[model samples]
Target: MAWVQFGHAKCGSREPTSNARACRLEPRKSMSLDRFGHSTPTCEAWTMLQSMRRHSQSFLIYVLFGMLIVVFVFMFGLPSTDSCDPQTQIIVAEAGNFEINDSDVKSGTMRTFGDTLRGGDKEFKAAQRQVLYNMVTTLLVAEKAEDAGFRVSDDELRQYIVDWEKGNPDQLRYISGGKFDKERYKNFLDYYGLPTERYEAYKRRELLARNYLTMLETSLVVSQVEVRDLFEKRMNRTDLEFIKLEPMHVEHLFEAPTAAEVNAFLAEHMDEVKAAFTANKSEYSTPAKVHLKEIIVQKNDKMLRQIGTETDKAKAPDTRFKILKKAVIDNSMAFDEAAEKYNEALVYRANGGDRGTEELENLSKQHRDALGDKKVGEIVAFETDLTYNVVRIEEKLDATETPLDKVQSDIASTLIKAERADKKMDEVANSIFERVKNGEEFAAALEAVLYAETPAEVPPVDAVDPTVVPDDANPADEPKKAEEEAPQRVKVDVAETGPFSLRGASYGSWSRLPMIGDAPELARAALTLTEASPLAPKVYTVEGSRVIAKLKKADTGTDEQFAGQKERLIQTIRQQKSAALLGDWRSVITLSHPEPSLQSYGPWVQALFDQAQESGQFKVNQAFLTPSGSEVAANE
Candidate 1:
């Protein structure tokens, strides 16, 4: 009865019955073979005997199978307790009934951040938090989409892939080798560890999310007033006048920060210092580098003809290369001597063809491959873009990091210098600014503070004598000729107050004005002022010189100009408003589902394992999650 309840069939029953004793006997339709191989018809005693024997054998077999299963359970444990069981997967976190596990977190991290996982513990933890947040948000969005009855049919998914392949020619070429092949595309996904079904499901979720966001954005509207205001801001021009201040001019105004001052500054801005250090640590870490010496020969028609046979024109370069290769291999001359003798580039020849230390990644693929794993003193030859190179690896250095102790002092010194320079410039600017506010002329104040002479003025055209009358001019015709002739030169007014001036530098415009140097900052500042708010002085540093300027003029465009731009401005405003509304909706949706607590996830799993080891509760077999050799090779 127990075996029947557990899904085993009862003896003599055509259908699997739950009750062993309820098995009904059917009419004798087939002859039964006895132990001696004789066919027999049904009789009550004989049928009863046959049923008992069949039941006995079935019972015996079931017991033996049960014993085998019991043995397996003792040896390998139940499915729920097995580490490799899908149902018993390690759950990192849970949202409702959905469990997020270690494998899922790892796969998401790899998909999003790639090899940043190999970075230091701080970087690794940050990447893990980011991946977890993204996964939780994506899951929430997908759940919402499903609740809204959004589903992607098989035909739709197939057509989406087809459209994507058609749109992305480069990707298609890479996957299908320059031809469209459905099977090849499927294989490409498989090779990258993505199955076709999984990819299609991901795309369907992405499409639904996009559609949902689009729907939200459609509700937002841009008013006419907003459009008009935006257009005015964009099209309206500004004319500016401002002073330019240079650090060198005010360097004497302040002293260099003392060591104590630098230390105090560092303490005050420790957050910024730490951020800079973290961001630029790579600059302190040296990459694996190679030093090379190369002999280069430029290929030309003459060289090709000298070494090539007449039969194949394309093979000429190869033939010439072979000759050069044989010459280098024969050791008739050293590489340096050959470079000096044959190379036309002076820098290479003078340096004995030394290329200096170079990071392998910075080199071209052909060069990197040739030198990457080669030994010192080994020679390699390669051809590139109409030139041949025979090179030798002179030295190789393993990548090393500069200790923080060594670079900390240098970083502190640089930061202190920059701060001191800014302080000195600000002090000088404020001093000149006060003088200008007190009604002293801007140019005069700048000259007095910087102890610099005023700029020389360009002479007016009227100051130069009129072009001398032609020696052969008739007296009566001279008056008419003089009237008809162009004036000797056109007289133009130049600004006399400012150190440099740009006339007609309109608001919200970049135009090169005559007579004054191009100083956009001066122009922009000048545009913000009017006659009523005159002399708004500011200092600007231009080309290592301090330019002190004050507003000279301001002008606004007419209403007609604005009217012409209204339609285009409305379109621009609508696009900006739609994007902003969409962004706001996304933010709200993301916040609606708070990120799962990742304290016990990602790299924290290692910490837990470490605690377990100390307590003799667990042992770690593998310590790190570095990519395998094949993975690294594929990436390279």
Candidate 2:
């Protein structure tokens, strides 16, 4: 990789720049891969590369390279907040003789997501595991396809390209007047970054996988019995009237512990309380250092150079810093809330950026500047070329510890209150199911359990909105258990999942039952319900919430309808079975090569990667590898 200055040497035969004879070469720059990352490139470099490419005139090579760049940018985006490499090396995972690289997992993930790893690192981590599982499975199955004598020839690849060109009528301009123009074809291919020979090889592998799957699947004859069962299940859609409850939603129903109860809890559990305080003694200790919280903003050129330059408020760069400034500086939101809302790095975002306490000697220059002349409760919005920290000086603690005796009463009350809230969540949910199961109406059961207390008999309606399901029901989780504060007017809801097949795809997965979330118990019970036995047998717990569902209605479509849709149903079932068959192969692959397990970058590499940052070598573009990126976690 030589960067040579192309000009005529001591030979005085330079007619013009382009026509110059070969001359003494000069190194334009020394060897460095740094420019490839965040470093800016000179326009001269582009001019030189163009000149070099043209003199050789590798139209096909240039076109393919151009397309690859476009596809890469389209799928993963560039320089996103979470962008960092995964552990140890470029080749991240292995299976038998085959290995899955960072590039392979990344390209495969592009099938289901496009620049979708924006929520934060945890979401990216989960997606990474799932897609890695998908890829490993695909690779092993593809290998099996090859072993089963499945092969895609060069002629086949060429034919695929030609057919694609013919099929895309909008690209007809490349074949004007019924005659293909070679240069025009090149231009057209350039837009798509047309598949090169290497990419063609990848396609060939996938083609083999597809063919092998087809061959195996074609023999899957859906018997009459299976067809009838599938048809019956699909034709009969059941509706469920369900009551949703969460500990977070209804924990308010339980009042604080009585003085007598608090004293009794202390008498019985003083040792436990002492142990809890010892474990979380930081809550009572003050070190001779500064306590800080930061809303971390990634460094970018716009933020570095032109952030405050905008005079009009609307014209500001809408980076994390902009959001943080508005929330913490102007609008007076808590630093943690701002971090949770806007910080790109989950390590800092998780605990709201609290760096519990930092000794002055170990503080970075940036931190020192933010803290200079600032006392406790002060803040400084600060930045460097690499980061912009919305630093809040939470405290400047002296070396001191609050004795356990100082907070013994408060701890005892909290422990009892939390215990009661946990018990009450189940009690309230079971109460609803018990009464409703015993001939009580649904609305009456909810109102009596949630609002006003009465006899065990169910009472009246106290539904929230009743228009749409609560936002929490969108398969998102509730707050963790027992982190209760003041009483909240339980935001409970009563809704009905109209009618759906027990096994039908609702919102893309059967696990995600409509308006009830991934509660398999409620879904299974709903499927079993009929007019005679409408209520689910038990309260189901999901993400700190409980639910009890009743059957609303069931629709059994006519056999004539099944007759009309028989062929389509068979095809869908065949496809599903084929997918499951591939899944079986994946399970086998996973068992064979369990290192870099789907859940993580495996223990062997994790030990090497546990370093705060693998910023040393093999920097994975976090956009590509996603998951852990660099683990320079704030650990607040």
Scored by lDDT, the top model is 2
Candidate 1 local lDDT, 107-128, one digit each (tens): 5555555564566765554554
In model 1, what is the error at residue 205, expressed in angstroms?
15
The lDDT per prediction is: 0.50, 0.56
Predicted candidate 2: what Cα RMSD to the true structure?
Answer: 20.6
TM-scores of all candidate predictions against the true structure: 0.41, 0.40
Candidate 2 TM-score versus the reference: 0.40
Task: For residues 363-401, write the lDDT of model 2, one tens digit per residue.
Answer: 888777767878888878887767777888877865789
Backbone clash tally for model 1? 18
lDDT value, residue 69 of candidate 1: 53
- Model 1 lDDT, full chain set: 0.50
